[model samples]
Each structure stands twice: as structure tokens, then as C-alpha cells.
Target: MPYADVNGMSLYFEEHGTSEDTVPPLVLLHGGFGAGEMFQPLLAAGLGEGRRVITVDLQAHGRTPDVVGRPMSMEAMADDVAGLVKELGLPAVDVLGYSLGAGTAARLAVQHPDLVHRVVLVSMPARREGWFPGVRAQMDAMHEGAADALKQSPMYELYERLAPRPEDWPVLVEKVASMNRRDYDWTEELSGVTAPVLLVFADADGISPAHMVEFYGLLGGGHKDPGWDGADRPASRLAVIPGATHYDLMFSPLLVPVVRSFL
Candidate 1:
């Protein structure tokens, strides 16, 4: 129930783990239409055992109400995260984001390198086109009336249960849909990120395998097989968990160990 007045929004966040833990905190950013609670499976798996875990509800999502005039964008969400870090008086923290949150995390690492120590990007593509054509088409369909159409879905139910203002569901949906319609390319900016990164996705994710490899290559990974001596290994790590998909990877059993190992 804690709210940080940041970046023109009342950003809601929760902290887990003991302050006595030695490891830096990990900030968990959820995907589009998801709240921080979506990471409960990972949290229950002890991802925060030796570290603090910070989870946030991004603009117009979960407990945080949308700013009246500010449209949601990755850049703006990243700024809000940076501001939250500052407000919390932390020097730096590790960031883990999924899908929409992944894009925001990537932008955070690029725009505020000094505030990020490590990054975990889950089910995110480097560019809009990295998603399969049909996936992209599905994303394009999230227009104004999509909220009403999705009322019977779990996402809508979750929002209704958790949002500060359940009546704002349609408004939130419209904002998210509007944001989705915009195109973006973060390839150039991603190349400049200095933090060590871990890219994770399901084998059957929305992103194509070729695009996944391409994304890894941009992160200085997948260029060559690591020598037996481990001398030529890439700083970044790539993990494609079997039997998982974009919508369910967060709850996948394979996610925690991979994330813990990388961090």
C-alpha cells in the first residue's frame, strides 16, 4: 500500500526481504495489464532470499492511478522508476522486467545507467517488428473498445479486484492500447547499456527465435560458442525455457533459478 509520489503519478510499490540482506534490491516490473503481484510465484520461490525485492505498479496499472494528462510510454515509465529509486535513497538496484516492463527496464538501464547494477529482460523484443507478424497484429487490435471486449478475461478481473478505482478499467485499457499502437526501436540504445544483462523468454514466446538471437547478438551474445576455458563467453546471458509461453513464463518453474543465477 506504499505510494511514492513520483513523476506526476502516485506510484505504488512494495518491498520484500530484510534490510539486513547483503545483496542489492531487485526491482520487479510487470508486463502490460499486469501488476507487481504477478511476480508472486518468483517471490515465493525465494528470489528475494538474500536480497530485497521491490515490485511496482506502473502508470494506470494496479493500485497506481493514471496521471490525468500524461500518456503512458516506456520512456516515461522508466523515468518514474528512476525517480522511485532516488526517492528510496538507494544508490543502485538490479532490475527485472517482463514484456512491457522489460522495455521500460531496458530504457531505464540506458537512460540511468548509474542507478542500475544488473538487468533481467523477460519476453521483450529489441524492436516492435521483433514480434511475429500475427503477434504484432494482435497488439494492434488493442484499441479503445478492446477493454469492453476483454471484460470477461482474467486481466480484467484482476484489475477490477486490485485497482484503486475499478471504474477506471476502460480508461486504463484505452491508455495501454493507445501506447501499444506506437512503434519503437531500442536497438541502438540497448547497445549502449553498460549493465550486465540477462535476456529470458519462453521457447514458444511471441518473439521469433531468429529475433531472439538477433537481440542477444546486440547484447554482445551468441556471436561464438564459448571456448571450453570460458574465455570467450558473452557478458550477457540468454535463457529460453522449454514448455513456457509469453503469458505464462512468469509463473514458470524454470524462471527463478535462471534469474537467480544471472543476478
Candidate 2:
């Protein structure tokens, strides 16, 4: 129930573990459609004892007040996050972000590199030219309930295959609806980032498998296959999660170890 007023918005946050000197802290930035509590189960399932976790509700989502400025770009969100970290008096913290959150994380690294010790981007898309227009169109059509639109969306297909349940659809729909359609660019910020990054993706993620690979490559991060080759880049790495789709990747058991290794 704790909230910090940042830039005219009430940002809600939850903390876990002990904030002692022995334990380093981790910040969890959810996808645009997700809330701070999305990672709740991970906290209880033994994410280690000495680590502290801070989960936040990004603007206009969950318990946070909507950010009325600049149509919700990743840069704008990153500013809000930076302000929150300062308010909390954290000198530096590791960041773990998924999908939309990944984009925000990239912006944060570029804009405020000093505030982040490490960064992780999961299920992200490339910011290159002409990469995501088709994907965004499909999602828009589905959002408007166009005929067979849902069937056409790779996101919906992946979600069905991975997290299909009567109750899950509503949550998914709500989250997608929360996205600010104007703020979805990350290409400009990727190259300027100097922080160590861990890029993760699922083989079956219909939403952005190809774009993810492209993004991985642009970061000078080396993928096992078909991604950017950064054999010489000392601070970046790419890992593909087998047998997992995008939705499934969120709940995958490997997330902890993957994120922990990077931190």
C-alpha cells in the first residue's frame, strides 16, 4: 500500500526481503500490461534470502496514477522510475524487465546509466525501421474485435498455447488495453546503453520472436543462433528458453536462475 508521488502521479510499489547491506536489491519492471504483483509468486518460491525485490506499478497501470504527459513513451516511464528510485534513496539497483518493461529498461539504461547496476530484457522487440508495424496492426485489430483479429495476432495465439484458461484471457486483455499506443520505440536508445544486459526470449513466442532476435543483435549481444553476434562485447549475452512461449516464459522456473545469474 505504499505510494510515492512522482511527476504528479502516485506510483505504487511493493518491497520484499530485507533491505540490508548484505543483500543487493533488484527492481522488477513489468510489461506495459502487467502490474507490480505479477512477480509475486517468484518472491515466495525462494528467490534467495539476502536479496531485496522492489516491484512497481508503471504509470496508468495497477495502483499507480496515470501519467498524463507525453503519451507514455519508454523515456517518460524511465524518468518516472528514476524518480522513484531516487525517492527511495537507492544508490543503484539491478533491473529485470519483460516485454514492454524491457523497452523501458533499455531507455533507463540509456538515460540514467548511473542508476542501474545491471539490466535484463525479456521478450523484447527490435526498434529498427519497419519491424513492428504489422505486429502492432494485428494487435490493434484484435483490440477492436475485428473479425478473426484475435486469431491473427501472434500474441493471442502464443497466449492461448501457453496460458489458455478462462480466467487468463481477461487479465491479458486488460493488460494489453493499458498500453499507451504512442510510446513504443526503443531503437534510438539501444546503442547508447553501456550497462551489462541479459536478453531472453522464447522459441514459440509469436508476438515478437524475430524482432527479439534483431534487438539482441543490435545490442551487440550474442545469441545462440540467428541474433546479434557480440563475441567481443564483454557486457552482453543472449539466451533462448526452449519449450517456452512468451506467456509461458513469464512463469517459467528458469527465470529466477536466469535473472540471478545476470545480477
Candidate 3:
């Protein structure tokens, strides 16, 4: 077990694929209400082969403890992750984040570009507006009162099994709920990102395809055609995995190969 004191809380992280691997480390960030374990399937699929893979448990999620008065916010989580990279003494690392983690990953690439070499954002959009109306409604329903009901969900089960204090489940719920209630839009900032990015989404995702295309446009994509020599292509990519949905894309077998190639 390894822990790092960062940003007023103790953060937990796991390593795979060896420290000696020549490739830059890949930081795997899990979705909201989940832990690093969600990426087990991807890691098993050899995405980490011959590279260092680091999976972090964000604040109040997984093995990381939620401190009193310390609520979970995208900004805080991004800072904590950057602090972890600094603590590890890595000049820069590749980042792959799913859902909530994707938000943090994108923020790092935008606000802390020096710490990120390349980034993969899975099932996430640059703004809350990108999500379908119903999806935003569901997020609004996530209050502390919903914690007990969510216990029937595997997300809760995993938290119970891995949280430093299982009683904090409700706390985590409220914090995330609060964070979600606040509107966010990173679209304006993304164009300034220095690192290359990969935007991956499920074909049947919460984010409409049109919005995703707009997101790509913000990344300087799709405005022009890529010439035969690949000279006009954007530094970023947009990949929508076929026959997948947001609920299951995290474990989609097709996910590993695409991400591995991008990294």
C-alpha cells in the first residue's frame, strides 16, 4: 500500500507494468463513484505492457480518504493528481481518464500541461451542456439521501469494499453531487492545451454525437480535411467505439487497442 500526502488529503495510487519500462508512465483515472479497480480489465488487456501504468484513487474515492471540510471538486482533484506526479518525480506522464476522471485529466492537460505528455478522455465532454438532458437530470438526483439506495449498485459495493471509511459513502455522494450541480464549461480553454489529446466515446453515449463533434472542433479538429500526407490533421483525435454505451465502454474489449495505440 502506498499513500502520498497531497492537497490536504492522503491519496492512494497503484503501479503496474514496472518502473523500469522505457515508455512514459500512463496514469489511469477511474470514473466518478468508482475506483482504480474499474481499469483492471484494460490493464489485463495489455494496454500497460512495456510501459509504466499508474492508477490513482481520487479524493474520497477508493482508498483515498475524504477529509473533513474537504469537498471533491474537479480543480482540487486535478491539483492533487499533479502533486502526485511531482511527488513521483516524473517530468510528464500520459493520462487516461474515464467519465469523472476524464474531467480531471482534461483539466490537467489544459491547466497543467507541463505534467502531461498525452491524454485520453473517455466518455466525458468538455462541458456539462454536452451531456443529454436526461443525463444531467440523473446527475442532479445524486444527493446524500440517495446513498442508501445506491448501496444496491456495484459502484457502492466497490466503495464499501475499498473506502478508508465506508461510512463516508454518503459524504462522497454529496460532494460529487455538489460538484455536479455547479455548471462547468472547459471548451474555451481546451483550444489552448499543449499536449496531444484523444477523445474516446461510446457510440451510444450520454453525450450526443453532435456535441462531441463540436468538442473536437474546439480541439482544432474537423475544420479542414487531412491531406494524403496527414499534414492537415489535428493534433487530437476523436474515436467513438462502435456498439458501446457509456455504462459499459469502460470495459469494452475494443477500448484497449485504441488507447494503447494512442499512448
Candidate 4:
């Protein structure tokens, strides 16, 4: 029930775990059309055992109301996150974002390096073209009325349950669809990110394996095997969880360990 007046919006967020000094806090960003509660499984799986976990509902998602004039862009969302971090009085924090959140987190690391210590991206691609052909095609087909079209879906039900203004679901959907239509390629920005990163995705994710490898390469990974004593280890880590897809990757039992190891 906490809201932070940040970046021209009242953003909602929740905190979990004890305030332990040895472990750094983690800022969790959820996927598109989803809220902070989407991470409940991971939260229940002890992701916050030794650390503090903070989950946020981005603009127009979950308990947060839509921003009147701001179109949802990864850059603007990242700025909102940075503003929240500043408001929280944290010098820096580790960030873990999925799908839409992942892209936003990447932007955060690239644009506000001082606010992030490390980052984890799940089911996110550095470039718009990194998504598989079918996925891209599906995205291209989205229109302003998409939310009304999906009113019978479970996502709509969840939105109605959590949105500050449940009737605005259609508006949120339209804004997201509009944002998705915009072209973007953040390969250069990814290369410039100074924080160590963990790239996680499903074996059958929306991104092609080749593109995943290319993304890892840009992050200084996949060039060579780590030598003895791990001297040649890359700062970034990549994990492709078996038998998982974009929709289920976050719920995979394999996710927690991989994330913990990298963090």
C-alpha cells in the first residue's frame, strides 16, 4: 500500500525481507501487463533470504494509475525507477527485471549507472529484432482496442482486481500497444553498461538462440570457456533454462538458483 511520488507519477512498491547489512537490496521489475505480485513465486522461494527485495508496479500496472501524458517507454520507466531509488535514499541497488521490466532495467543501467550495482535481465532482448519472427509479427498486430479484445482473459481479470482505476484497463492496454509499436535497438547501450549482468531466458523463449548468443557476446560473454581457476570468466552470465518458454521462465524452479548464483 506504499506509493512514492516519483517521475511525475505515484508509483506503488512493496518491500520484503529483513534489513540485513551483509546483503544488498534488490529492486524487482515485473513484465508488461503484469505487476510486482507476479514475482510472488520467486519471493516465496527465498530470493530474499539474506537480502532485501523490493518490487514495484510500473506506470499503469497493478495498483499504480496511468500517467496522463507520458507514453510508456523503457527510457521513461527507467527514469521513474531511478527516481524511486533516489527517494528511498539508497546509494545503489541490484536490479532484476523481466520482459518489459528487463528492457527498462537495461536502460536504467545504461542511463543511470550510478544507481545500479548489478543487473539481471530475464526474457529481454537488447534489440527489437532479437525477438523471433512470430513474436514480432504478433506485436505488430496490436492496436488501440487490444485490451477490450482481451477482456475475457485472465490478465484482464488481474488488472481489474489491482488497478487503481479498473475501468482504465483499456487505456493501459492502448498505451502499451503504442509503446510496443515504436522501434528500438539498444545494442550499443547494452555494450556500454558498466554493471555486471545476468542474462536469463528460456530455451524456447521468444528470442532466438543465435540472438541470445549475440546479446551475450555484446556483454563480453560466450567468446571462450572459462579456464582453470576461473581466470577467463566473463563478468556477465547467461542461463537458458531447459523446458521453459518466455511465459513460464519466471516460474521455473531452475530460475532461483541461477539468479542467486549470479547475484
Candidate 3 collision pairs: none
lDDT of 1 by residue, 79-151 (tens): 9999999999999999999999999999999999999999999999999999999998987987768778888
In candidate 2 the C-alpha lDDT for residue 143 amounts to 46
Distance (Å) between predicted and true CA of 211, model 2?
A: 3.6
Give Cα distance to truth, residue 122, candidate 4, Å.
0.2
**lDDT of model 3, residue 172:** 92
Q: Model 2: per-residue lDDT, tens digit, 110-229? A: 889999888888877655332346655655544433324544565445444433142344444544554534445566567667778888887776446666666666777553443377
Which ten-residue region of model 1 has the weakest summed lDDT? Answer: 16-25
lDDT, candidate 4, 110-167, per-residue tens: 9899999989999999998999989988888998677778888878888999998999
The model with the greater lDDT, 1 or 3, is 1
Residues forming the 10-long window of minimal summed lDDT in candidate 4: 16-25
For all the candidates, what are their Cα RMSDs to the real structure?
Answer: 1.1, 6.8, 1.1, 1.0
Instruction: Give the Å shift of residue 170 in candidate 3.
Output: 0.7
Badly placed stretches (over 4 Å) of model 2 are: 19-23, 68-70, 128-134, 142-185, 207-210, 223-233
How many clashes show up per model?
Answer: 0, 1, 0, 0
Q: For each candidate, what TM-score against the reference?
A: 0.97, 0.76, 0.97, 0.97
- How many steric clashes does model 3 contain? 0
Q: Where does candidate 4 stray beyond 4 Å?
A: none
Candidate 1: where are CA atoms >4 Å away?
19-22
